[model samples]
Structure formats: C-alpha cells, structure tokens
Target chain A: MSRSQQLYEAMILDHNKKPRNFSVMDPHTHSSHGKNPLCGDDFYVYISCNDTEIEAISFIGQGCAISKSSGSMMTEMLKGLPIQEALELKESFLEMVSTDISPEKKKSLGKLKVFEGVKDFPARVKCAALVWRALEDALGAKSGETSTE
Target chain B: MLNPNIRKQFPVLKHIENGHELVYLDNTATTHKPLRVIERMTKFYTHQNATVHRGVYGLSQSATDYCEEARKKVQTFIKAKHEEEIIFVKGTTEAINLVAESFGRFHLKKGQEILITEMEHHANIVPWQQLCIKHGCTLQVAPIKDNGELNLEAWKAGINKNTGLVAFTHVSNALGTTNPVQEMCDFAKAAGVAVLIDGAQAMSHIEVDVQALNCDFYAFSAHKMHGPTGIGVLYGKHELLKIMPPYQTGGDMIDVVTFEKTTFAVPPARFEPGTPAIAEIIGLGETIDFLTEIGLNNIFHHEHTLLNYANIKLKEIKGLRIIGEAKEKNAIVSFVLDDIHPHDAGTILDTEGIAVRVGHHCAQPLMKRLEVPATIRASFSMYNTLEEVDKLVAGIKKIQGIML
Candidate 1:
C-alpha cells in the first residue's frame, strides 16, 4: 500500500459520503460549469462573494471521487478568505500539484499535498484539477481577473 | 483455428514489463496485431506499394488487386450478399458518420425519431444525435435494466412508424453486454425502421453474419480484430447502398465528369472518396483469415470461460463491486472498488505489468444512467488466459489492501 493510495482512499470516502459544501447556494455571485468530454467528468462551482471577501463557496455537480472531493476540499479552504487571497491560493494550488515543482515544496503545500500523488498517474491529474479549473473559471468570470499561474 | 502455437504469432505478447510477463487486457481498445497481418502490410509496402485505381502501370495493377481483394475478404468475412456492399472507411467512427450523412440525410425526416439504447458507445450515439439535430428529428434512447441489460420491451415501445432508424451496439464495450441484435433488427423491420449495428466490439469477440442479423448496416474496425488500425468496413445492403448518396465525393467514385454535370460510380467505390488505407486493408484480410482459422466458436467459448472465471474471482473481493453484471455478456468486467479511485487502480495494476482501461469509455449517457463517474474496465481477448485473470485478481486485491 503506497502512501498516495492511502490518501486517495481517504479522499474518495470523504467525497462519496459527506462531501464538503455539497449544496447549492441561495444567492451565488459567481458560478460556472466545466466538463471533460473525454472522461465524462462534469461539475459546477458556486461562489458567494461580497465586496472583497468570499462569503461562502459550494459545489453542486456530479463527477469522480477525485474531482468531487477536490471541490469539497477547495470549498472548505476558500470560505471566508478574501477574494484576492482565494485567487492566489488557486495559483499556489496549481503550482503545488504541477510536476514542474520540486517534491520538497509540494510536500510543504500541507492539506493541498493530497494531490501530489496524482502527478505520478497522469490520467487522474485532470480529475484532481477539474474543481480547481472550475473555480478558476468562476472567479475569473466574476472578478474580471486573470489567473497568473 | 490459428496455428496451435498462436502465442508466437503475436510479437507483442512476448514483451516483458517491469520484469513481469505482460498481461494485456485492453483488447477492447485495440488488439495486438498478429505476425501474418504485420507481414501482409510489410509486404504491400515493400513489393507493391503504389497509388491504387488510377495508374496504368504494373504497380498500380498490383496495388489495385490487393486493395480490391481486401475488400472481397471483408465482404466474405461479414457474409454480405455482394462484395459491393463492403465500403472501406477510416474505421467504425467514420463508418457511422458516413451512414449518418448519407443514409441519414436520405431516409430521416423532420419530426421523425432515431431509437438507440443507453448502452451505445458515443460513436454510435453522437452521429445519430448530429443527424437528428440536422434534420429536425428526435433522438430517443431505450434505457437499460438494473442488470445492465437493455429493456427489449422498452426498445420495442420506442420504435414506431415515426422512427426512422434504430442504431445500437452489438456488444457494450463498457458492460460487456451482448445485445440481442438480430431480434432487435427483426422488431425494427416489423416497425418499418432501418437498423445499424456498431460491431466495433462485437467483431473481435463473436462471429458476425450481417445477412443473418439482417441489419440494414453493420460497421466494425480492423484494429479491434487483430488487424492493423486506420481501416474498417461498412457493410450495407446492396439495395440500401444503391439508394444512399455518396458520403464524400472525389476521384475514383466518379463515372463521367463534364463541364455541365457529373455522374457517380456504384455502391462501395462511391462511398470511398480519397485513396484508402490500402496497406491496412490488406492486413485486415490476413486478420480475417487468422480468425476464420481459429473458428469463432472456439474463440467464443474460450472467452466465456475466462469471463466466468474473472467474475467469480472478482466477486470474492470484499469491497469490489463489479458493474454491468448482464446475463449475456462478452469478456469485459467493469468494476469500482469501495474507496479507491479507478485511476489509482489502473496505475497500481500497470505497475504489476497488467493493463486495463479506466474511465467512462466514451459512453457518457450510459455513465449518467448508471450513476458512476468512471469504472475500471478489464476487457479480454482470445489471447488472454486464466493465468492473466489471476494476475488481474491479485492486482485488484493489492489495490484494495493499499486503499483500505
């Protein structure tokens, strides 16, 4: 049993049973849908933003455990963070999972480090990144901001 | 029957991975080519390679003969009434699109219906969807039962006088469900609807008799049947072919071109526009001969035993849930572990020199119906054995242990 496999199992269980923020928001300031036509992974992210801070974040869609759980974890991490900080966190998350980053820095990404294992399996990277992409799209469209990562 | 020493006929089977013998379970995607098929392609390129059907030289005659002979082989393999019924296309995807463009344009009307099942591959579904959208027709799908089998009653109910065509897969690539295509065709005929069977998965596993099935059109790829890729056959009835317009227009399919008007050639040639996949077509001929020698009955029995063994062994795993447990199935087994992601399972198996497909398998609508994001699919070919099945089971157990 690899450590990566252990982490993936935990993530899948978390996503399947009590997914984090797995509900639709009443008044979402931003929302976007993304789909991977090749593997049929589809999901939507809803962001509730007020002025400079993210009031709440939720996702309501169906996808693989990786994407779903990633969405859940992203929501849990991004809630109450300033919108600019949330966008910055998305960039840092991208760099953390990308293969170009050194392993030491990847391990330092902390809770976001669960995704480092996905880099070894190229195919799953898309699933793990689906939520991030949706979040990026939603935030970009809402704030008229472009991702620097 | 392939030569008794058939293992030697495939060079790739002899390959070793990670110090372990290779156990390929991805035949549903594309099969390893037999040596005879390889040799035929090599020989074509080495000795008689030339542009076909236009040159008056010796090379042209040889190339044309090999190309036409390959078409005849496909004609005989599918047992089509006439050789002209076999039109060489890129593969099953292109063949379906050809039908959608030509026959679909001619037969389908506004407000008509196109009936397909939930088990259809995207190639079978998307083409019809495009046609329906183009012609103002409706695309209706017959849903599957809990056991992953098509609801025949629902299929019958879906077809009526307004149904223009009923297209379905002969075998479900994801579920391994062997659809009752002939029976479905009979019902469609009674309903006055044309039927097209996507034999991409079926051609490799079972003996296909288009005439017996009485489908209006049958499509299959060479790569799935131990042949080369980039080549496939579209078998349509001669009457239907004659009525359908050309899918693509170009050189060989033209009869006489005048400044004012142009006339087209007949049937097979009319559908094939540009230069075909000549070398691959010849290789497909050799692949058919290899399968004919092995006899589909023996191949079918061998795969059935393997599938049953795999099913029983897979059932013993504590947290593994096999998807698509259809009563009538081919040699595919799709499953999802209790906690592990399918991609993780695939990666773990690959490390042990076992290869399997992991994903939705281009059946998005079916996935939506099944309520699964993705599944790990282990598909078998005649070349696979019980020993490989054991490796697969062992790999899955290891995956479960690691995840748990």
Candidate 2:
C-alpha cells in the first residue's frame, strides 16, 4: 500500500465518516477542549466517570479525518476502561506516534495500531493525538484547552 | 504569458517528489529561491565573509559595502526616498514589532485608537494589540465584506479624531484581496493619522511605490520574493525614523557609550542593533536584480494570468467552494472541498507532489469571518504553469474519490 493509503486506513476512514459516540456528553464528570495549533483542529472531549471507570465518553469538535477518527476511536476504546487504564493507554498511544514501542506493548494497543503510520508522517502525529491530549488534560487536575504544538 | 524558461532558473523545480514532478503553489507563503540567489549567498560566504561596520580590514569594508548596497537596492525597489529609511530586520513580524514598539510608544496615548482591517495577518494585529494593552490604547478593526473585499467606507468611518494610526495589508495573504492602499493612506493622512502598510504579500506580485502611496511605514519580507530567508525591510519616512527611539539597544545602534551617558546613532544605524544577516542581505540584493531584470510588470502579468487560469480550472471540480472571491484578487486561490477537510486534501495533493497551504493562514479572525475552520491555499508565481493547476484540480478529484 502507498503511504497515503496507509495513512487513510480503511478502519480510520470508516470511523471518520461515521464516528461513534461523536457528541457532547451533558453533566459529564470531566471535559476539556483540544486544539492542534498547527492545522486549526479544535475538539472537546467529554467523559462521565463512575468509581474511577469511564461510564461514558463522547466528543464534539471540527477537525481533519485523522483527528475525528482518532477521537471516535478513543471514545469507543475508553468507554468502560478505568480512568487509570485510559490514561495509561493515552501514554502508550502518544509513545507509539512519537517513538517506537516494543512489540508486546504495541499488541496491547489493539485497534489503536492503525495509527502506527502516523510516526512516518511527522505532520499528522498531532492529528492522531489531538483527542488523546484532551483526554489526558480532562483526566488531570487541570481542565481547559490543551494545545498539541 | 509566464516564461516557461523561468522554471529552469529555479534548481529545486528539477527535483522529483513522491515519484512525481514537484508542483509548488505556496508562493504566498514563501517563494522558491533561484540559482542566482543561492549562488550569490554562497559566493558572499566563500569570498566576502566578514563582520560589517567595525573592522578596518579590506574584506570587512567590502562586506559592509555589499550590505549597504543591498539597502540601496531595497530603497529603489520600493521607491523609498532615502536608504537610511530602510532598516534590515529578521522578517515582516520583526518589522511590524519594531514600528509598534518605537512608533507606537511615541505616538499612541490613552484612549487613542489604532485602526486596522479584519483581514490583517497576526503580525499586523498582535503587535498593535500588545501596544493597546500596555498603553490603554484601543485597537479598532474595520470589517470586510462577505466577498472578502475591504469595506472602504467602513474603514474611512473608523478613522476618528482619536485614531492614532491605520495599519493594513497591501495584499491579503489569506484572501488575496488587494486593499485600496493609496486611497486609504490619503484618507488617513487627511485625518492626520499615520498609516503602516503590511507589504509582505504584495512586494513580489505587484510594483510597490511607498512614496506614491504616502504610507508612513511599510513592512515586507525577502523570502516571499525569491530571496533568502532571515532578511526583510521596514521602510519608514526619514522624519519619522529620526524621532522614534531605537527598537533595540546593542553594539551597532549606539554612537558612543560612556559609563555616565550614552548617545544613539541616527536612522538606519539606530535601528540595526546587532550584527545583521550580512550574507542574506547580499542574497536579497541579487534576488532583486533577478526580478528587476525580468521586470516586475512581466512577472505580475504572468502571475495574474496563472491565477485566472487556476481559478477557472479549480472551479470546474464539483464540491469545491472557492473562498475569498474578491474582485481584485491576484495569485492566491483559497478553497475548501465538500466534506473533505483541508488537511486531508493537502495530504492527498502532497502525494501527487502538489504543495499547498492548509490552515487558518495566521488570520483566524478572517477564518471566522469566512465561516471556514481552515482553507487550502494554492498561490502562484511567475514560474508556475497552468499544467500544474490542472494537476491540483486532478489531485482534488482524487482526494474526493478516495475520501468521500
């Protein structure tokens, strides 16, 4: 497959076109806005946590296909995971896009591996990590806009 | 008619990218340097590398001569009255900041206004904003029409007794709207207001006569005009430059520094603080020679024709909405494809070796005005061909087919 094909993977395309849980979560326990200053991709992530587990996750924003799909996939992946596990996953995903991860750690990422092509394209790494950065901020003590510079 | 031979002068055009010939349409961002510019810079470093304005050595004198000669070229290029009025800075941003710091601090007072247009780049907007916040001055913005044209009537109305300065772009980087600079400057002058024109996007595509426009100050970059980066010019009137204090204090800007008292230099030396980008300035002089030899009129006509061709060709593609359809637009064409984000479109275009700019274009206020999150911009130069425009259209079609 070509570099573009690898970038716009079938699963990524499907998620972008018909995003799951792609809406605002009202009365959410945690929420934060994310912005990719380089490309002007703005997004807001919402999560409802119950006993440290994310009972619900949703996002509402406007961005490129990679960002929207990553947000959609993030919401789907973090729905039932505990807040700690979700934060760990966010760390793993950031590492995967920024640097090389071990095979065992990569396998643990599951469907998130579709973003492995992101490391090849330095410009698109921010697109894939927009929502994850928002999640990281929303999960932390601080809650505001997070910029992926 | 753009000379096809012009493409051969740019050595980068000979290379291939992504298994396809390069189609560089980001001229509005920064133009590709010609072999003349590159060779001049290389020659300067190899033969004439010396610190200017302190050394008595022959090489130092030659380097200083080259630097001063570049300033003269710039003064003639922009039709400034004196070479001392041209201050070499980092780029357009630094130029504007210098004006905002030196001129703004001297002129602006509490409750006064610095009027600007809604279509200004962040460079033209933010420095004034900083001045406003610091001095309790008001930063007023004139609105743009829906078609991306500057509302001239509104701009005139915004100029009041308390309006201290009027800053605007000669050509819109994002929308490609050429503002009525002469008329605006005349009106502002009638109001006893100073006008600063941001000529970053205008210098390459059009012939700029600062004296004719009667703007108090003008700022532009060299990289956008097929010159080397890290060099630009800020042309201020001699009378204005003589009064405003130095923007930065350092070795060169001072005439005599004593323990008890310090005296500053005059005009250009007062403005240039540190060791300048000597080689880049020499390169800029060479680029000016290259452009002047071809004639700016010929280059302007060539780019205008290419823009018209690209406008017609890109419009043929379905679901592609061309943004900023100003009546007086030049070479910039910014648009959006239906349901396909600009980043995706840019990626697809890149695969076909077509380079374009995709974002708010450092004019977020204009983006909000246009009601687009971002746009894909393909700006042309004299070296670009209509065939490259066809490739852009074809690339957009391929992106639509694959993504949508």
Report the number of the highest-DockQ candidate: 2
Candidate 1, residues B300-374, lDDT tens digits: the string is: 888898899999999998888999988899999999898666876777788788989998898978888998878
TM-score of each: 0.89, 0.97
In candidate 1 the C-alpha lDDT for residue A68 amounts to 73
Kindly list the per-residue Cα lDDT of model 1 for residues A7-35, writing each as its tens digit.
46666555655788988887888887767
How large is the i-RMS for each model, in angstroms?
Answer: 3.3, 1.0
State the number of backbone clashes in model 2: 0
Choose the strongest candidate by lDDT: 2
TM-score of chain A of each: 0.83, 0.96
Once fitted onto the true fold, the runs of candidate 1 whose alpha carbons sit more than 4 angstroms away are A1-29, A40-65, A72-82, A102-108, A142-149, B1-5, B15-20
> RMSDs, each prediction?
3.4, 1.5
* lDDT value for model 1: 0.84
